[model samples]
Target: MTRPVVATIAALFKRGHVLLVRRANPPDAGRWGFPGGKVDLGESLEDAAVRELAEETGIQATAKQVFTAVDAFDHDESGVLRHHYVLVAVLCSWVSGKPLAGDDALEARWFPIEQLGSADLALSLDVEKVAKLGAQIHSNRAFELGF
Candidate 1:
């Protein structure tokens, strides 16, 4: 029996920049995206996001809220779906430490969110859209709380 894979992604934003990592694994190898990985058994979504972020990038972060979720599917040449993942994007704030590529990441760096459209970034899946949405959500929350 095939089951949908659950994964988590962290959108770490600070000063108009978002932390991105180049994936070192398959299904989007070498593409830039958030630092995240599969949700371990008996782990909460937020916990998974935090753990994945720390595992992939040496940056310590605290997950605030879920920004969005996306469905990613890979198909074989015969149109058979090989893999599917339900990726939950969590908006997080940096708590401490600097980014260093580790685990499933090839490289890690911060990208200006405002320049996403014109930037020469090879983003994976719906990363650009998720980052934009996360920015909007963060902005709205800050405004609502008068921060």
Candidate 2:
């Protein structure tokens, strides 16, 4: 039987903004979302998140924690499940590099938290909510550590 694919989405927060990528492939093509993809067979979630962030956005980041998980189910018009993904959201701290769209992304850049669900931008399902939570979590952590 087929199983839900496990993916890792990096919530790499930097300077009060979060990194996002405009997807170049389907499931959610053309929608802006956190950088991520299917996890490799032998890869850990943290590693996959960091790797995907780099692959899609050319941004180096360190995965600090697993913040949350989201279930994404794509159904065809006939109501058949086409894709089911368990997306693990990882909180990451920026290490280096600038946003350069690559891999499965058409564009990569940072968006301020306020702009996440703006009317002008097309965002993947639940992306804005997840991104906002990530920003909040990271901000809380930073404040706790006196950063």
Candidate 1, residues 26-81: lDDT per residue as tens digits? 77889898898889899998999999999999989888998689998878779899
Clashes per prediction?
A: 0, 0
Weakest lDDT window of 10 consecutive positions for candidate 1:
114-123
Could you give me the TM-score of model 2 versus the true structure?
Answer: 0.95
- Model 2, 7-121: lDDT tens digits are 9999988888888999999778898999998999999999999999999999888999998999988888898999999999999999899999999999998899899868998
- TM-score of every model? 0.92, 0.95
Error of 1 at 135 (Å): 0.8
The global C-alpha lDDT for each of the candidates, from Candidate 1 onward, is: 0.88, 0.92
lDDT value, residue 2 of candidate 2: 88
Clashing residue pairs for model 1: none
